[model samples]
Target: MEQVLVEEYRNETLECLHRGHICGVGPDGQVKYEVGDADFVAFLRSAGKPFQAIPGVRAGIKEAYELTDQEIAIMTASHRGESFHLETLSHLMDHTGLEQSNLVCAESYPMHRGSREQIIRNQGHEQRVYHNCSGKHFGVLSYCKLMGYPLEGYEDPGHPVQQEIVETLSMMAELPADQIARGTDGCGLPVFALPLKHIARAYLKLSCPELIEDEKTREAVQKITAAMHAHPEMVSGTNRICTTLMEDTNIIAKGGFKGIYGFSLRQEQLGFAFKIVDGSDEEWAHIVVSILEQIGYANQQTIHRIRERFPSAIRNDAGKIVGHTKEVFHL
Candidate 1:
C-alpha cells in the first residue's frame, strides 16, 4: 500500500511533484502490479464513456442509424471539437432528426487550439456541439429515441437512459448497481464512482469483448473498440495523448477529467488505471508511458514516439530548454 511518486518537475531544481496510484489487473481480477492503494475510489469521469455508449450500441442504434465506425468512435469519445469532429456529430444529429438544442452539455469552445483560433477568427460563438462531451450526450439522447424514453430529463439519475448506463456498468464491473456511488459529471450527466480495480475490470471487458455474457453487448464492445482503434482521431484529435497512444499501439486508452487514465492491453488481456492525487492532467502522459514500459506492454520505440509527440519538456519564452518532467514511479 505504498504511494508512489509518479512525476517530478525540475528547473534549476525540483519545482513540483505529483504523487498518485497505479494499478494493473489481469482478466481474473488479480492485481498484477500496484504502486499505491489500488482500491482508491474516484469518479470515472469521461473514462466511462465507452461503457456509457454501450446501451446505445446494445439497443441497435448503430444498425438503425447505419452508423459508421467513425460515428461509433465519436459516441465513445472525448473529442477535441475539431472541424471533422463537429461535422461527424452534425451528421449523427441530422440522421436522428435532432439538433444542437437537444444537447444537455453547456456551450464551449473547441479544445483543439487551431480549431479554437479558427472559430475566434470567424467571430463564431461557443456552441453546445463544440463541447468535448457533446458526443456522449448525443449517445444518451440517441438511446432515449431508440428506446422510446422521454428526452426532457434524460440527464436525471432516475431516467431510463441513466439506469441503463448504470446497469451496463454494473454488469461489466461485476458489481451490484446499488454499491456504485453516483454524482453529477462536468457535462451534466450522472457519473459513477467505484474502486479503481473495478474500473480496471470494466476496461478488461472492453479490451476483450468475447468475455461478455450477452451476445449483443459483446458485439457492441467489439465494434466500439475496433472503431476506436481504426479512427483514433475521432476519439480525440491530433496531438492528444489518447489519440496518439491508441494510434501507435493495439491498446485502447482513455483519459478522464481530474487526472484519471485507463487502458486495456488487448494482447495480454490486462487492464490498467491510475489517478493523480492533485488532478494534474499534464502529468498523465508521462505516467502512462512509464507504466507501459514497466509492464512490458509497449516497446522502447513506442515509448519514444509518445515522448516525442507529448513531450514533458518545460521551456522558456525564447524556447530555451528550461526544465523537464520525469517519471519517478516503477511497478
Candidate 2:
C-alpha cells in the first residue's frame, strides 16, 4: 500500500494518507486490489472518451468531419498538448463551425515538462485550446452539429451528446443508466463514474464487441479499433508510448481524462484497466510498463524503447535518476 501511495502521494504532507486506487482485472473479470471497493464507482474522466465517441462514430461523421484515425483515437484522449495536438484540436473546431476562442476547458499545460516549455516559448501565452482535452471538446461540438442537437449545454449530462454516451457506456457494461453515476468532466461534460470492474468490462467489451447486439454500435467499435491500430502515431503523437505501442501492436489503446488507462489486447481477446491511485499522467508509464511485463510483452528491445520514450525517474543522493526514471511497477 505504501508503495502504491508513493506514486499517489508525491507531494509531502503531515497527514497519513489512507486512500488508494485500482489496477488491472484478474482472469475472473474482477479488479485485483483492496484499497478501494473493487466494485465502487468513480468517474472515468477522459478514460471514457473512446466509449463516448462511439455514438458519433455510429452516426457516421468520421470523414464528414474530416477526422483521421489518430484524431479519432485521441478524440477519446487526454492528450499531451503539443503542436500536432493543437492542429488536430483546432481543425476539429473549424470543421464544426466553432472558433478557437469558444472552447471552455480550464487551461492545462503539457504533461511533458519539456514540451510545455517549448509550446509556451513559441505561443507566448497560456492556451486552453492546446490542452489535451480540446479534441474531446471539439468532438462534442461536432456531435451536436452532426446530430442536430443543441450545442448549448451539450456538455451537460442531460444533453443529447452525453445521453448517447451514457447509453452506449451503460450498454457496454451491461448496466442501466441509474447504475452508473454521472459527473462533470474536466472538459465540462457529463462523464460516467462506474465501478472499476465495469470500466474493465467496457474495455473487454471493446475487444469483444460481438457481445453487443446493437449492430451499429458494434460496427463503430470495430472501425475505431481498426483505425487506432492502423494509425497509432496519430492516435497519440511522435515518441508517445500509447502511439508507439498501439501502432506497433494490435491492441486498442487509449489513455483517459486523468490517470485512468485502458487497452484491449485483440489477439488475446482480453482487456485491462487501471486508475492510478493519483491522477498523475506520468504514472501512466509505471502502470503500462508493469502491464506489458505481466502480459508477456517482454521483448528487451521493445521495453528498452518504451522506457526511453517515457523514462521513469528514481532519485539517488541528489534525487536524480542518473539520467532517467527507473521503471518500478508491481502487479
Candidate 3:
C-alpha cells in the first residue's frame, strides 16, 4: 500500500500529497527501514544506466577508446543536453567512431531551459544526438562494435548486447535473471523491473564493490562509480538531483524518468531506493532530505546543498511566497 510521504500546503491548507514506497537496505543486504510496501516492484527506468553501462566497461571500452572519466561518466547519464554534455558526447563519439545514426534514442532538443531556448531562437531542429539517453545508447553501440556484434536491431531484447546487459544487472542485483521483469524503455532499450529492496541492494553493490565475489564485475563497478563521482556534472547536469547527490563523493546516486531514485552511502554502508506512486518527481528533494535526516547522514553539507538547489518554498509569478512542500513520512 502507498503511504503519503510528502504534502504540499497552500495558504496553510493541504493542497496535494505525494505517496510512495521507500526501501533502505543495510550493509548486510537486509531491509532496515521502509515506508509503504517495500516490496513494490517498479521499472528501474534511467536508474538502471549504471548497470547498463557495466557490460561495456567490462569489455574494456575505456582502454580500447582511451575514453576519459567524463566520457565514461556520461554513458551513465540522463544528461540535460547542456553545452558541456554535448561536447562530452561529441568527444565520446569521436573517440569510439560512433555516428549519430548509430543511436536509436528518439530525437529531441536539449532538456535544459537555456539550451532549448537557444536552439529555438536559432531555429534549430530536434536531433537524436541531443536525446538524454544518447550517451547510454552510444556505450552499448561501442560495446557492440568492439565485440563484433551487429548494430542492426541492437535494441531487440534477443540481441547479445542486450542479453549481456540483463545478465550484468542480474548479477549486480543479486537476483536471478528469470526473476527480473523486463520491458522496453522510452529510448528503445530494455527496461528492468525489480522490487524496491533489490534496487537498494544493487546500489549497495555499486557503493561497496568489495562485497562482490567476482573480480571483473567488482572492477567494473568501481570504475563506473568513480567516474560518476569524479565528474558529477557529466552524470547529469547543473542543479540536477543526480549531479547534486553525487557531488558528495561518499554517495553514489542516480534517478530515473519517473519518480524513481537510488543511492548508496559508502561510509554508512546503506542503500536506498524510492518511488512516488503517482510517478511525480516534484517531491524528490523533500523526500531525499527527509530520508537523510532520518538516517542521521554524516554529511550535512550535502543535504544543505540539495535543499538550496531544490527549495521547498514555492513562489508565485511575481516571486511572492505561495506554498511549501513538507515531508510527512519518517524513515
> What's the true lDDT of residue 62 in model 2?
88
Q: In terms of lDDT, which candidate is strongest? A: 3
lDDT of 1: 0.86
TM-score of 2: 0.80
TM-score per model over all chains: 0.96, 0.80, 0.98
Best by TM-score: 3
CA error at residue 24 for candidate 3, angstroms: 0.4
Q: What is the C-alpha lDDT profile of model 2 across 1-331, one tens digit per residue?
A: 3244323223333222223354455434566533344565667876677787788888887867777776676566667775666666666666667765656777767765677898678875666776767777776677778878877777677787887888889888767888898777666778788877777778876777776789999999987777767766656677776776675455666776556767766555556666655556666665666567766773556566777776655445986543333334445
Better of 2 and 3 by TM-score: 3
Report how far residue 294 has shifted in candidate 3, in Å. Answer: 0.5
**Tens digits of lDDT, candidate 3, 176-223:** 999999999999999999999999999999999997888998999899
**What tens digits encode model 1's per-residue C-alpha lDDT throughout 226-281?**
88999999888887888878875468888899988898887888998888878878
Residue pairs that clash (backbone atoms under 3 angstroms), model 3? none
Instruction: Tell me how far the alpha carbon of residue 91 in candidate 1 is from the true structure, in angstroms, after superposition.
Output: 0.9
What is the Å distance of residue 50 in model 3 from its true position?
A: 0.3
Cα lDDT listed for each candidate:
0.86, 0.67, 0.92
Candidate 2's displacement at residue 46, Å, is 1.4
Q: Hey, what RMSD does candidate 3 come out at?
A: 0.9
